[model samples]
Target: MIATDTLDTPAAVGSSAPAATPALPRGLAGTPDDKEMLRSAVELTRDIATARPEVYWPDMLLSAGLGYAALAGAILIGNPVLAALSGVVSALALYRALLFIHELTHIHKNALPGFRFGWNLLVGIPMLTPSLMYEGVHTLHHARTRYGTAEDPEYLPLALMKPWSLPLFALVALLLPIGLLIRSAVLVPLGAVIPPLRRLVWERASALSINPEFRRRPPEGEFARMVFWQELGASAWALFVMWWSATHSWRPLLIGIAVISLTALLNQIRTLVAHLWENEGEAMTVTGQYLDSVNVPPPALLAPLWAPVGLRYHALHHLLPSMPYHSLAEAHRRIVRHLGVDSTYQKGNYSGLLPLVGRLARSTMLPR
Candidate 1:
């Protein structure tokens, strides 16, 4: 979750704020205000493509359906070989849908009341996670995550290694992907059993920053409810798949379950790549939001598959959570216009890596 201090700063269109300095792979800098970003995206969208309302709606639906069908068919056939194939197709589609989920959250709705709810229900159930919570938490992360000591939970967890420990550190970082699977499949679920453990879960669910510097006075009951809603939603989807697998055949059901879990796991890794190592000990002020956000365009092959849903122009989304996801790339383009290329990552190349390689390199986050 993005803590209050993590998100309290701001970056404006022309303001010379000292944004988060780039230390990672992407060309991340500056935490500009949402309006400035929105304006930029609007201008850029005019040049790239029409930024129409629901522009990517059809594409999202078609891909999701295709992915869903592929997964289901593969499972129904009861061939392990087919299941693997379907998993790939489904994983790709699900990934793209995730970006849209981000985009959809940024959408402003007035006329499409049922459409909004239905959309959430459909996507939420299948994905086994609530998009709304991620939207909120992600906004905070983008706003204030870059400026912290080991104190920030989003950054380092404190306790740096001595020179002797470098080998161990490197070893663990190399297993990032494997560690991620372990964390998700085992750690997260196991941790929930204890009180302190549960509170952390609650904090994450509510998007509360655990770091005292970034802590906000949130509504007490809200986070627990979010925890219930989000987890139950995902678990319920799993149960539904279990039942479906039992009836029509276990193959598709098991495959769906695996694909869904793996996809979410992969998404978590993507989130990690955006900002796993950047922070400052500086005292945070309202203007501090500028130093936390970063931007990168994934490889072209990955973008069409993932950007429409919201992963492509992510830095802008962090700076301006209110801007819809579909418009992020454009919004980023706009910010780049005034801020120069340094404001964004121009590369359209996917960073090819497995989860294991990522963990070994940066355990703070899962692999992208």
Candidate 2:
């Protein structure tokens, strides 16, 4: 449940007044764990913990295949209206495929066999967002001691920020395709020769993170080897795309960027509601983290479109991070049935996207 207690900081009533950083309300300062809820979550969903290779392979391949096919239609078709529709389809499909990176992070290296390689080849490298960008980085966001804190790369206190930050957050995603293009095509290649530049890129520009202060440490051992290959593949693909655009018409490349830009916009909007963003750089209890996160469950039919691959149940995800995407729905149903409507579990459930966004916006407007 969201804490109803209010922040006590002085109000920033005028533009001239500097806004003080917001704090988590006293009621939420050190919320105790809901042990019953945590135990039940584990016990109820144990059967569905295994990642199914069959489901993962077909779904990812199909999504990537459809995305590329629609992208081709969008670029080649002369009709403006049809091309626009194709672009939308391509964006949505590719977005879903790209999100499989989340699954890649949680699943064991051996769980899905060559699934990681397949994904990087088909979707990740092509998009210039290889798994290396997320693999080691995202797990920190799930760490019990790091979540919602300054150490968490994927977290920020957005609800405690100025009102304009919300729109700015989503708007920045529109430039992601261009930013990624430069990173892979120019930065990665240049960084290969300049050790300092490579180190800087790895620390600052590698992760898909919201917290500007979080810097990724150097990769080591097996993961370091993985990063090297993934970076090489992404850089090569980016350079090839640049060469193709220079030799051929620029229409295809430009259209592809536009489609990816739409995908990034959709992802950024989804990120806005992924959490309440109320924690003030403090480590949260499991229950606090669950409440801070969100779940847009059944009957809100459009959620799957915006939060695909079981992301609609994001709060539940924090509870069972290792649970495969295909199994989250059933796990949600079982947990909800066991815990009932009034449980802390249900507090994470929300109606739809707009209400959550409005709630975050209103929180930002509260006295700083």
What tens-digit string does per-residue lDDT give for candidate 2 at 1-368? 34545465775666676676555544343566789999999999899999999899999999999999999999989999999999999999999999999999999999988999999999999999999999999999999999998999999899899999999999999999999999999999999999999999999999999999998999999999999999999999999999999998888999999999999999999999999988887678898888889999988989999999999999999999999999999999999999999998898999999999999999999998
Over 1-368, each residue of candidate 1 has an lDDT whose tens digit, in order, gives 12332333556778888876443222122323345434554555555442354555676677778778877766666777876887878877766765555554455555334444555566654554455444444444434434344344344322222333324433333333333333334444666676665556445533323343444223347545654665565555555655666677765544555676566555555544443233334423222333343344544454444334555454455445555555666565555667565432232112433432343255433332
Backbone-clash count (model 1):
28
- Candidate 1 stretches greater than 4 Å from native: 1-52, 78-82, 109-112, 142-250, 280-294, 298-301, 306-308, 334-368
Per-candidate RMSD, Å: 10.2, 6.9
After superposing candidate 2 on the true structure, give the runs of residues whose Cα lies further than 4 Å from its correct spot: 4-29
Number of the top TM-score candidate = 2
Per-model TM-score on C-alpha atoms: 0.57, 0.93
The per-model lDDT (C-alpha) reads 0.48, 0.93
For residue 356, what is the lDDT in candidate 2?
Answer: 96
**Model 2 misses residue 181 by how many Å?**
0.7
